[model samples]
Target: MAEWVPVFRGEELPPGLMRVVTIGDQRILVANVEGTFYAIGAVCTHTEGYLDEGYIEDRTVVCPIHFSRFSLISGEVVEGPAEEPEPTYPVEVRNGIVYVQR
Candidate 1:
């Protein structure tokens, strides 16, 4: 029953940036890495830190609370206080817009 939802214009998020978006009740974290877009659960696995408030380093997002690092593309925990990997969603771009499948 899932479908792709348009979240933002592709140009709104530049490389090395992230944003938090709400799609019908689900909160998601979106990132841009060198032009490719990625989507993941918005909350950090360890302490529920808002990932949109996190810092970007290389391809990783560092949680602002406990400094946990997660891969922007895979949502794998790169460095932690977090042992669980974040839930990653499929992302696509079409007609100069970015969409996420939930």
Candidate 2:
């Protein structure tokens, strides 16, 4: 069974920024796109690059190691070097707090 875990305060992550968080044994990459929050696997599928160290362009996140682009919405591989799609988690913001389903 999965439960919603409070990861961070909403104010902690501003627009166009992201951070890596650990919930249980999972390392998740949390991104703030405009005002919406998105959660995905922290590791890049291609080379295990830390996605938090990468940058977001529009709605895609580019890997820092090999520049593989992954969609923030669907976690799909938008560009190559990575054939596998990252796993995405359900994110919700409640009363200025951000939570991720784990």
Clashes in model 2: which pairs? none
Top-lDDT structure, candidate number: 2
Model 2, stretches more than 4 Å misplaced?
A: none
Cα lDDT for residue 82, model 2? Answer: 97
Instruction: Give each model a TM-score.
Output: 0.94, 0.98
Candidate 1 residue spans exceeding 4 A from truth = none
TM-score of 2: 0.98
List model 1 lDDT by residue over 60-82, tens digit each.
88999999999887889999889
Give the TM-score (vs. native) of candidate 1.
0.94
lDDT of model 2 at position 97: 94
